[model samples]
Target chain A: MEALGVNLPFLLVQIVNLIIVYTVITKWIVGPIMGLLEKRRETISKGLEDARVAAEARANAEKEAAKIIADAQAEASKVVREATERAESAGKDVRAAAEAEAAKAREAAMAEAELERNRILGDLRGQVAALAIAAANKLVGEALDEKKQRALIDEFFSGVKSGKVVVVGESLSGDAAEVTSALPLTSEEQDVVKKNISAKEYAFKVDPSIMGGLVIKVGDKVLDASVAGKLEGLRSTLK
Target chain B: MKRVWARWVVLAAIILGLFLFTGFFGIGLGIKPIMPHVYLPGEKLSETPLFGIAGLYPTNTLVGLLLADIVVILIAIGVSRGVKSGKTVLTGISGAVEALLEMLHGITEGTAGKWTKQIFPWFATITLLVLAANWSGLIPGNETVGLIHHYDHGYDLKQVGPITTIWDEGTDDGEHHGEYAIVPFLRPVSTDLNFTFALAIVAVVMIQVFGFRSQGLGYLTKFWNTKTLFSKPIFGVIDFGVGILELVSEISKVLSFAFRLFGNMFAGAVLLFVIGSLVPVFAQSMFYLLEFFIGLIQAIVFGMLTMVFMSQATQGHGEHHEEAH
Candidate 1:
């Protein structure tokens, strides 16, 4: 060992020096660097986690917003559909009501026209009878009274109400008959017409434009015999 | 294939050119031819009385050891200062120190496990000190520049002048030319057995301390297993004999560790001297590189050995053997 210069004091000193270096390096250098690296890594990971959470929240919020918009759209469409259906139904009801009212007004106007035509026809017949009486007086030297004229017109209407005017004989077995005339038929005349027609059900109408005609309709058949009807028939025969 | 051959040709040409230049052109340029200077272990430049004491003197190796310590301490101080400055990232020399310490931590931790934190200091110290001491010789003036002493036909202590004036020329160049040898003020620290042995002793002592700490008094059973003797007589004798061998191995560890560092560093120094003498110029550079790696390897080997021994010592003999298997 002496040949190798193994001195105790110097070895001790070297050992001491080494220990000192190790202590300083460990305490001052390694400790701080390790800590810094660990801290930086942790901070980075935490930031990443926070970013991920924020992105997830954003996605969730977007989904919720989309759902609300979709829900609102569905609700709005449902409301519009209901409103459109309600408006269309109301228009249909109004159309139906208007058609019915127009039909009723047309029927009333027709009834009034028939009444006026019947009055006019009655006046013309009275005039024609007066003229005929005057001419007869001139020819035979006599005057016709009002009571006799009324009896002649009533006799003519009785023949039509009893269905005797019908050219083609028809079976009168139906439960109902339709009666049409130029003048309004009174309740007594309607009963007489019903008794003569021998039908329990009856429909009566007046159209003065027909010129003193009585038309009877039962099922698909019709009988017409009046002054206007005979004149149309003579005209058609002349043509 | 053509490109690869071209690259190889270029590499070969460069190598040949380097060899030719160092062999022929280098010498022709008047580079001085250096003679290998012979040196003995513990040779000193000069001896000075310790604190002016008449008979007490400090050896030159002691001065070298002190120089190594001062350098290491200054580095430690510099590193400490860098750390104290509170910089987030180490740079330059402090960075190197931190890297070295970090590497040491990896090595020691692998062997020592939990006790790495406790034993890493000693391991770092030995490695750094040995590495620094070994590398110190590569510097320009180490073991080269110092005072010169002149002696006549026969040299004697009484024939020399006062300690301070040892460099002074006492006699002129006359009929008899006295031979002289240089005594450098500083030598590489690892070349001194005293420094290496001191570090080894410290390392071995710490191993025992760790062993005691880990296994308590039971650690001594590795050196002497008295309980095994009565239980199994035949196996007990073998166990007892093995214990004695273990004790001798422990003592031998210090000597071997010391000599291992001393031998490598001392041989590296001689190699540098011989190479420097033979071609005094560019030739020494390659050897310097070799010495550099040698220094690094020796430092690693010494430190790792200490760590391994400390780790092994901490475990009981049976457990250590089992682990070895």
Candidate 2:
């Protein structure tokens, strides 16, 4: 009965107590705790699932937002590019139109200048003739007869070479015509001079005070047959 | 009805056979007896009280009850095992047994709410085993055995009739010397106060364990109970005094269980002895029948009280009041 001299009643009580404790812990404490743990686990799992779903939703929304921003940027860039292209094309058209207008204005100015130059040249030519006539009149002592002056101019021009005489004057001859017709001209010049100038009794009468004498003009030479010219010849003979 | 009759018939046959064997051969069969009066090992051997302040000591009855309790535990474990494994046959048998145990557990737990299930296994096992051990005394040779006499004064040996010596012996020299009348076989274990006290101590200790397990350290505070006292100082002193009384009452539970069981069984034994000795013919048989019923009833009452008191001790007073309501 005394295995280890342990109090038998005490041992019995301990055993009984152990049994009761085990039973109570198992049935009451452990069972409820397990149930609570299972419920907690389910709740945690559901929460995790919901969190995952929310996270996914947030990610999707973010992605959509990014896509929208990207699309907007692309659209904005597209609009910008289109606007730039239109601006460039408009600028090129405007530049080309300006260049064309400038070229037309230059052409018109050149033509107008050419016309003005020609009109001025004509007026100068008349002034030169008037001056030449006044100088000649001053040099001459008296007026020569028209027929005598014509004979003298013929006599002076008959002594020169046979070539066309070119007269530069303001008007066609009146008194100088006899002297101009007495001169012979080259064959080539004859045809051209006959078409361009008057051949019969041709004269270039600038002015009557260019001293009423026959002045024959040839290529580079001029012969003066006037009263002032005879007096200058006499004076030179005395000296 | 037929099964009940068959059980009765079998029990009668067993009794008849035992009676014949004991009456004719006097073979000294079954349990060996050591004394005319039952000797509880704890009371005889222990210098300290069996369930002293230190706690209870193990005795022969305690050992027997423990063995019986172990068997009950094993059976319960087996039943629980079957329940876990989904075995149909074991499940069916276990279910029936578990249902009975569970019903008892439910009643106790209903009183304590969720706490009863925790203590149910130990409580039920102790109750059933103690009940069985107490009733075992009614078996044929439990109280009847070959006799050996102690000296009327000292240590000399004598001889006597198998069961008659318990009443006849006294000190031979009249010097107030204590001597034991020895028997060759069986003793009714319950007749010993030591055995009953050991069982009570175990029940009491288990009640504490259950209380602690259910309510934690708060259970110990129930004994002191200063909360209400604090509110009402004069009432508190009285309540504190009552707390001391409660401690005393707890100690009395051991005495109650021990004295009640011992008194009943011893009284029944004495009655059987007187009746059988006075009229050795027909009255002996009649007394035997009465002893049989008395033994069963006493065992049942002891077990029932043990169950009830243990349940009460572990439970909170509030729960008891609620149940009463």
Grade the docking of candidate 1. Answer: incorrect
State every prediction's TM-score relative to the real structure: 0.59, 0.41
Per-prediction TM-score, chain B alone: 0.79, 0.60
Which lDDT tens digits does candidate 2 get at residues A108-135? Answer: 9976875565456445544544554456
Instruction: Give DockQ for candidates 1 onward, in order.
Output: 0.22, 0.04
Off by over 4 Å in 1: A8-239, B1-29, B52-67, B82-88, B151-181, B318-325
Residues B1-325, candidate 2: write the lDDT tens digits: 9999988986786666456333446652322112234333422223355546555533434444454445445555665565456443334534554444545555556655555545455545544444455555555554444444564532333334543443322345534343544443444556555456666776676677766766677676557767556677896677667677777887897778767777787677667656644443455667777777776566556545655665665666534532443
Q: In model 2, which runs have C-alpha deviations exceeding 4 angstroms?
A: A1-239, B1-103, B146-149, B153-181, B282-315, B318-325
> Can you write out model 1's per-residue Cα lDDT over B18-116, one digit (the tens) per residue?
564345655433322333355546665546755665433466566666666666666667666765676645678767876877778778878888887
Fraction of true contacts retained by every candidate, in order, equals 0.48, 0.08
RMSD versus native structure for model 1: 10.9
C-alpha lDDT of candidate 2 relative to the true structure: 0.53
